[model samples]
Target: MIRMIIPLAIFLGLVALLLVSLETAEQRKLVASPLIGRPVPNFTLPGLHDPDVQRSSADLQGEPYIINVWGSWCWACREEHPYIERLGNESGIPLVGFNWKDERQDALRWLNQFGDAWTFHMVDFEGRAAIDLGVYGAPETFLVDHEGIIRHKHIGPVDQTVFEDLMRRIMEMRSEAES
Candidate 1:
């Protein structure tokens, strides 16, 4: 009876430790990306609106922009769509969308339904660009500076708080660049 109780207690302790670790990881707002502080990956994907038109990292170099990875199948993208639209409208910032592994028609329909917030949507049907950016899933965003360096990355949906934080960072970066 004593041996059985000890073994049960050990098992419970291990389970508790695992749960704690997982909870701590989940609480983190951003997952560190290897590409941070590096140049944006070089890849030209077709435009979501017009497949014949393409945009590459070179096109995004003139100004600071946010590259938001999303898909029609991503529920979190839907949840965050309004805030993204607001960010684009209110801030007048260039917001680019990387449509990851999604059907072009579905992506267009989704954007049409939710309201298009992106200045230009890059269609990444094969997810090759996403892979280069170290994307784990949809709804991840990368804040690229004017020189095309990836300054920060947000792993989840961008909410009001996240948007504010990003704005603050961008302002700081701009100020630093000017000075």
Candidate 2:
């Protein structure tokens, strides 16, 4: 009878542990990227509108800007597209785009259909630059400072709250730079 009770206790303990783990997993959020506070990765990709025009991390220096990683095929990008357009227009922040792993024509058409929010778009056709940037998926955004350092990374769509947070961080970075 004692031996049978021990087995039952062990089974109950295992069930409790599994239940706790499941609950924790449901509450988990996306982890913050370690690349925050680091320099932007080196990359040169062609412009989406004009392949002959290449943009690089070097060219993005001397100004605070937002690099939005998107794809024509990404539905989440569509959801965030209008907000991004508003962000560029309202904040006066230069919104650069990294068109990740997408066809140039499809991207162009999508932009034409949705309205262009990007000040300029870089074509990451082969996704090499996206890989270097540690991109997990489309619709990620990185806030880069005037010195070309990555200050913040947002893993999902940039809604009003996210944009507000981004602006706050940008202002903080600017103040830090001035001081």
Candidate 3:
């Protein structure tokens, strides 16, 4: 009887440990952020505003730029639209958008209703490009240096404070490069 109880207790402990391990693995997937201080991905997709303008990962190069992944279907995108305006207008970082998993017509309409703050918008109909960028959801912002290396990533809406802080950090990077 004593042996039976000890074995059962050991089994229960193993089960609890397994459950914890599984939960931790799942959380890692959801919380996995982009690998900054690395080269940004390279690819070209159709532009939302202009078909002639080739929006590519290479565009992220040659300037301190901001790549914002957004879709009309994403509620967070709508919430963060205004701050994107601040980035384009205030910070002057060639802001661009990845229109992930969105219909062309709906995207255009949404932009028209809100505001086309993006210097350029990529029409990512399938979200393949987004997967390559390690995007978990819309409204994720990446800061790339002039060399096209990702410096930082911000998840969720960008408010005034967030925008300012990012801008400051980007400016610091510029100064550091100059020095």
Q: Weakest 10 consecutive residues, lDDT, candidate 3?
A: 26-35
| lDDT, model 3, position 55 | 66
Badly placed stretches (over 4 Å) of model 3 are 1-34, 176-179
- Supply the TM-score for candidate 1: 0.84
lDDT tens readout by residue for model 1, 1-179: 99889989999999999999898986674567889999998999899888999888887786788888999999999988888887677655588888999998899889889999788889988878788999997799888888889999988888889989877887776665566
How far residue 91's Cα lies from its native spot in candidate 3, in Å, is: 0.8
For model 2, the stretches where C-alpha displacement exceeds 4 angstroms are 1-29, 177-179
Give Cα distance to truth, residue 10, candidate 3, Å: 20
Q: How many clashes (backbone N, Cα, C below 3 Å) per candidate? A: 0, 0, 0
The residue pairs in collision within model 2 are: none
Error of 3 at 114 (Å): 0.8
Q: How high is each candidate's TM-score?
A: 0.84, 0.84, 0.78
Give the candidates in order of lDDT, highest first. Answer: 2, 1, 3
Winner on TM-score (1 vs 3): 1
lDDT by residue for model 3 over 1-179, one digit each (tens)?
Answer: 99899989999999999999998985565464646878888778988878677767885676788888888888988887888887888765688788888888899999899988788888777778788888888789988888878888888778878888888977876775556
